[model samples]
Target: MLFDTHTHLDAPQFDEDRDETIARALEAGVSRMINIGFNRETIPTTMKLAETYDFIYAAVGWHPVDAITMEEGDLEWIASLCSHEKVVAIGEIGLDYHWDTSPKEVQHRVLRSQIGLARELHMPIVIHNRDAHEDIVKILKEEKAHEVGGVMHSFSGSWETAKLCLDMGFHISFGGPITFKNAKQPKEVLAKVPLDRLLIETDSPYLTPHPFRGKRNESAYVKLVAETAAEIRGMSFDELVQITTKNALERFGIS
Candidate 1:
């Protein structure tokens, strides 16, 4: 069995054939997936995916890019959603410097608030950090995020940065970028991250792996991430799948 610790299966890109994509994933050995919601708007779809697909779980939160426009009741309402049995965590939340979607200060404040809410809810988080590694690590440290461990979804950082997140109890999740020729940084991180802290994902319809790169990705392709992680760790594909699946379940409170 395999687990896709992070994936935006709720994204509009899957609107045409979401069910087909999910069936493909199941056939490809992805036994479990966490449908990541990036903002207030994405939460309903995320929850619906979880309700519709027994194997699909839900993670809801405001992304760094969309944190600015979220209304007052959004966080409170999203927090309330955590009470649902299918909801596993609070996330897809963090800092993103790759795009200037909002002022840095606003993103930082929103992230801080979400961090606190996740802690209060006692749920793991699914983090997304881009060019803002320093700030991401700083806020995680400042917020005492270790108390609520989560996965560093689509992790792309140096061993030093990976170490910081690992030290603070975050799992290092590798995605399609790890299979890219120019992705030296994530590759380096893949080689160094301990087996237990390792997780894999496709980040579907976004970072499709090598064999399917540039095409719309789905959870079925998660094995590609597992295959790549196996090569990085000098282990077999089955072993990688087992360890990562265990890690994903532990963090998300899944069976």
Candidate 2:
């Protein structure tokens, strides 16, 4: 079994053949997937997809790029959504200074708010950190995010930073980027982190690994991510899949 811990299947990119893609994944033993929500519009789609597929689970929140339009009632709204059977976590939320879609202050304000929502709802969080790692670490610490420990999805930071998140009880998730031939930092971190502390994902529709690097990624390709992790840790691919899937289940509370 394999778990795709972070993916934006709600995006229009999957509209063409979402069912087929998901079917391929399940057929290939990629049975569970975390479909992340990234704004007001996607919350419903994410939930709907989760309801449609037995293996799909969801995390609802605003991505930093789209956090601007949320009003006061929105956090409450997300809280209510978290009560649903399909909702597993709170996020796709956090800082992203790489793109100036919104101001840093605005991102911080919204990120903190969502983090609070996750805490209030007693759910884990799925964080997205771009060039704003320093501030991300700061906000996570200030909010005491360890209370609802979750993943730093698509982590691109150093082992020093990785250790900081680990200290806070956060699991580090690596995606297709870790499979890149030249992705030295992520590979190094992959080798050093204990298996219990690591998770693997495809982050599909983006970050596709080598041999399929420029193509559209899906849950089915999560095998490449697992294979890469296996190579990095010098373990068998089957063993890597077994352990990471367990890691994802523990993190998301999936049975």
Candidate 3:
């Protein structure tokens, strides 16, 4: 069995065949997946997906790219969603400096608020760091995010950043990027991360893996990520799947 620790199966990219896409994932050995809702628009669709599929789960939070859009009571909206049994985590929340759509200050505040909410709820968080490594780690540290650890979704940082996150009790997750031919840093980071702290994902409808690169990603393609991860760690494919699946279950408190 496999667990796609993070994904965006709710994206409009898959609206035409969402159910079929999920079926393909199951057929590819994906037993569980966490669909992220990073904004006001996606959250409801994500919850609908989680409620529909027994194997699928939900993570609700704000995305850094749209941090400027968050209004008063948005944090409370996310908090209230956490009470849902299928709402397994508070995340896909972090700093994203590359987009430049949201001001850094706004992004930081929104991230801090979400992290604070997660800590208050005693729930794990799923982070989305992009071009703001130092600030991400710094904020996480200041917020004492270690008290309720979470996954660094689709981690693209160096060993040093990974180490800091690990020290803060976070699990480092990899996605389709790891399967690329020239993804040197991610490969090295994956090889060095402890098996217990390792997880995999698709971030689907995006980050499509090798052989399928340049195409839209899907949860079904997570098998390609698992295969690559196994090769990188010098372990059997089955073993990698087992270990990562267990880690995901524990990290997200799925059971």
Candidate 4:
């Protein structure tokens, strides 16, 4: 079974046929999915989805783009939700230089705070890094995030960077970009990641895989990401599925 470890199923793009999208994922052999709650607005929706579906889980945090908007109460609320049966991790949290919606200093502060929260709670974190690799890695190390470990969602960095994250006890997760024809970095990173530390995600309602590019993404398309990852690693598709599914469960502490 495949596990889409990071997705935005709560995004409005899936509102039209969310049920059908989830059903398609199950039919496509995606046995589990983690809906990422990246902002206050999506946190309740994410939790609701997890509560409503046995196979869905949740990870809550403030996205770096919205870092400036996060208030103290929001952090407290996220911490409170961590004990929920369906909440699996603290994430979709990290630095994003691409959008710059939030100032770098604020993003850094928020990222560190959440990382500290995850450590205090003894929970794994799900990171989202974009165009701010060095600082992100530095902050994680400074915070000693290796204590709780986590997944680097939708990784798009050099093998050197991946090695650093792996050394810090972070799993490397790949998404739709790996299937893109011109995505050299992701392909290179895929070749270098150890199978045991590898994971797959769709980041759905976004990053749709090849052949389905430019269209709305959903969890069912994780199969294509797995297929491409398997090919890149020269492993059988079934083997890739089994290995990544195991990795996801291990990373998330799922049974």
- Report, for every candidate in turn, its global Cα lDDT versus the true structure: 0.90, 0.89, 0.94, 0.94
> After aligning candidate 4 to the native by TM-score, how far in Å is the CA of 196 from where it should be?
0.6
The residue pairs that clash in candidate 2, if any, are none
The deviation in Å at residue 170 for candidate 2 is 0.3
* Local accuracy of candidate 1 as per-residue lDDT tens digits, 33-59: 999887767889999889998999999
Candidate 1: where are CA atoms >4 Å away? none
Candidate 2 Cα outliers beyond 4 Å, as residue runs: none
Please give the RMSD of candidate 3 to the true structure: 0.6
lDDT of 4 by residue, 55-142 (tens): 9999999899999999878889999999998888999899999995899999999999999999999999999999999998999999
Lowest-sum lDDT 10-residue window in model 3? 246-255
Candidate 4's C-alpha runs over 4 A off are none
Which should have the higher lDDT, number 2 or number 3?
3
TM-score of 2: 0.98
Query: What C-alpha lDDT does candidate 1 achieve relative to the native structure?
Result: 0.90
Scored against the true structure, residue 43 in model 3 reaches a CA lDDT of 95
lDDT of 1 at 153: 88
Give candidate 3's error at residue 65 in angstroms: 0.4
All candidates: TM-score: 0.98, 0.98, 0.99, 0.99
lDDT of 4 at 218: 92
